[model samples]
Target: MFTHAGTLQHKFCSVAQCGVLIGITIGYTTTTAMSMAAVKRSNCFHKYGHGAACHVPNNSFMVIFAIIQIFLSQVPNFHKLSPLSVIAAIMSFAYSFIGIGLSVAKIFGEGIGKTTLTGIPIGKDFTAMEKMWKILSALGDFAFSYSFCFVLIEIQDTLKSSPPENKQMKKATAIGISTSIVFYMMCGMLGYAAFGNEAPGNFLTGFGFYDPFWLVDLANICIVVHLLGAYQVLAQPIFGYVESWSKEKWPQNKLISKEFSLWGYDINMLRFVWRTSYVIVMTMIAMIFPFFNDFVGLLGACTFWPLSVYFPLEMYISQAKIRKYSFTWIWMQIVSLVCFIVSLVAAIGSTRGLIISVQLFKPFQSES
Candidate 1:
């Protein structure tokens, strides 16, 4: 079903779009891992004092992972799995089930803890509700950029620090940024056009935003899987470094033995701890405030504004020897300031609603 749309309008759905959308989605997720890896690499430099430790491989690992996941998600035989892969199959099934199920919950005005009974009446326009909505939107809007802006800031730092010979790093960072912006804009536009005023709370669910369920599902799954892999990129380096240190600290202990491995870079303990933490934190967020769109919107704005807008301009002003203040630079600053303001508004407006979810997720009937 998803493939059909790609085929139907090859222009809007060309190989480039497929590649761009999937690549950017994966890049965004993968960059998190890369950032983690960079952090880990920095640690390695600090601990062993090896200059080579900070040398991160400038590769398209994120893109490869995204492509593989996208392809696997569409494989016909995946739906008809053998007994050996039952667990894998079931995990995939579970993702689809929960992903779509939670997405649908928002459309009926049921998600985000707002019930038909207690929700502000659609036609009832009290001064309180208006103020509440604005503040909630502000908070959510700002928070949405939490992850995004960090990446931008990191990229700027990298670009400024990298030697001119490190062309590969520059290329990779450029690809990551350019692709991400395009993807975000396209997805946001499509979602708004499709869902209009009745969009769902989730970012990728495409509930009221887009009707092509299977395509949207595939996209969401690809995105989620890509993001999951990204977690590993960071985890591996941190765990590896920690394990190395632990071995040095306690060479004879069996507990430390299990924690570190000299070969294959095994770090099961670290994986378990980090993944458990991630799941717990994300689940709390999901359960508490399913107003995903507002959350995403705010986060995006905050992140992009700080990194892309503020950090870049600030750094440029401080670092570069200027003959005069360029109009382009001034214009960029203005744009970033506007984005920051908008995001702040969205975040404050939406925070009240996170509390609202406690009431919504209260003991609903379970399907047997």
Candidate 2:
């Protein structure tokens, strides 16, 4: 982002980066807690009946997950996360495929649920305004799922030099995006086929698949593991920047300057305290407002236009020296304008959803 944007525009990049990074932390915290709860709920359903309440409040899970993340966040930075990333990727696939397989099973066994080209009718499960908000939220979810552009630069920095980064990133982007689209399409299509408009945001965690209770539990565990890895990947860059800047600003401060060894790992006092506090705050925020879909939608809407679309387009035009008011420049601006409007609507819808959820919410209280 800093490489090509105007000097004054660099701040926008930083804002976008920090906004999305903080969002990822909060969203992942909520998600992992929900996943842990889902595992327990699956077990309860298995032991009891499908009609059982199986209510699982996620506040305790969120606290436990925060404790784990406080330790994991102590890992140095993005450069040291290769093995963790690999594990995360594997778990990502594991849960995704498990979900896909379950959807297929439900479709074949129970037959397809009622579906339509245009989706739910006006007065069915949702009112007109509610449906409009949900549609917008769905758009935001799609945007959020593909909002990996911000991490490309960090991933590039971690690559070895042998295969040139630009080339590597090009190939990586192609493969990653292609695979992700296929996976998401299968999940969405099959899940909707199995459950129609009632399809859950997370089928494994939701009530969609409980017969194979053990598999459902396993998939939820996989989701928790994947989120753990993803949390660190999104966090380390911010950690590195903050710690480095603080060190430069306070070079002689003992807490920030000195490092102490714990077992085999060298731990810095400032890093320990700051990171632990950050995780605790994240957990608290998540428990207070554990609206996962709303969080994803708002964060996606916030970052999609500025970070993924506008910044990249501006950078490309600047780097390539495209003439002002030229054909390419005009089209890019047109695209950007369209995306900005989409993002605006998405943000509004997400805010509405969040407000509704908060109204019904009891802070740190169990809800099923």
Candidate 3:
């Protein structure tokens, strides 16, 4: 959409403003995955009768994961990661289905478990302000889950323009969204049914059945593998931006070749260094905070709101040259304003939660 606007202005201007926002999202997504991998590792260890001494620190696992990511980041191009991405997608589906199945089995064994209707009480417990804040935080999470739109342009760019690429992209998007919604609903409803109010931040960890220890271990392993692949996918865009920036800044640099020979095949050195450094920085952040849920909530609130809601609407309005006083424009403006306000509230709530968590020095506890 922004590309078309260049013709109107008689000059080419890319959406460089989005570069920073996308970079932040990629960093958060990578770190969040690393933190979750650590949590999963800790849980798996505890499940296998590991004593307290066997409990590796989250930072330790994070560092190890970072090393793995650094190696994987060396893959020359995003297209090369397609095979790993396919495996990751299958693993994700397997884990989600396994979780749903396990929850259903548990429910069959033990009748309908207790559940909560509303997330927060209307007046009995939290103040009105607190309730509103919590609701907004939940909204932020929902927005984040649906915020793959940031990557849509990249995916669409891969398609040939000769065909009706836009139409094909729209169809693909609808199918993808529909499938995700169904899977999310199934997994969420069943998970809540099984664990009720005691559900852990990660539903997979909440599963405590030992009779199926092998299956549980497999699921945990899949989670770790999927996160590794996912981290690469999210970080690729940042790698691209850095590579492009470096080339633009130093066009005459002979070392900045498109490909470098590695094991009889061409590899991009710029891709390797930038992506590896990005992973390293993300690893450091994960080690510093190491709180998976808090980081996810905070990232969703602070980044996804602008990337997912505000930018797309603004871009569409600009590209279409919608009049300021038109009904469609006015309605979109109001919606964007509301999204911005809600995002602000969510961000404040997330910050407060992180502060309390830090002050309490809550010991990391993984489900056994």
Off by over 4 Å in 3: 4-56, 120-133, 150-163, 206-211, 258-269, 318-322, 362-368
Writing each residue's lDDT as its tens digit, candidate 2 over 271-356 gives 99888888888888888889988889999998899888888888889889999999999999999999999899998888889999
Query: Is 1 or 3 the stronger prediction by TM-score?
Result: 3
CA deviation > 4 Å runs, candidate 1: 1-166, 202-206, 209-217, 234-291, 301-305, 322-340, 358-368
Give the higher-TM-score candidate: 2 or 3: 2
Candidate 2 deviant stretches above 4 angstroms: 77-79, 150-154, 262-265
lDDT of each residue in 152-260, candidate 1, tens digit only: 3223333534466357556756776665555445444443343444444444432332323344445455444545433333223333455577778887867656645
Relative to the true structure, candidate 2 reaches a TM of 0.95
lDDT by residue (tens digit), candidate 3, 84-151: 65686698788788778888888898855677697534566668877766676666566556655444
Which scores greater on TM-score, model 1 or model 2? Answer: 2
Rank order (by lDDT, best first): 2, 3, 1
Model 1 residue 192 CA deviation in Å: 2.7
Best by TM-score: 2
Instruction: State the local distance difference test value for candidate 2.
Output: 0.85
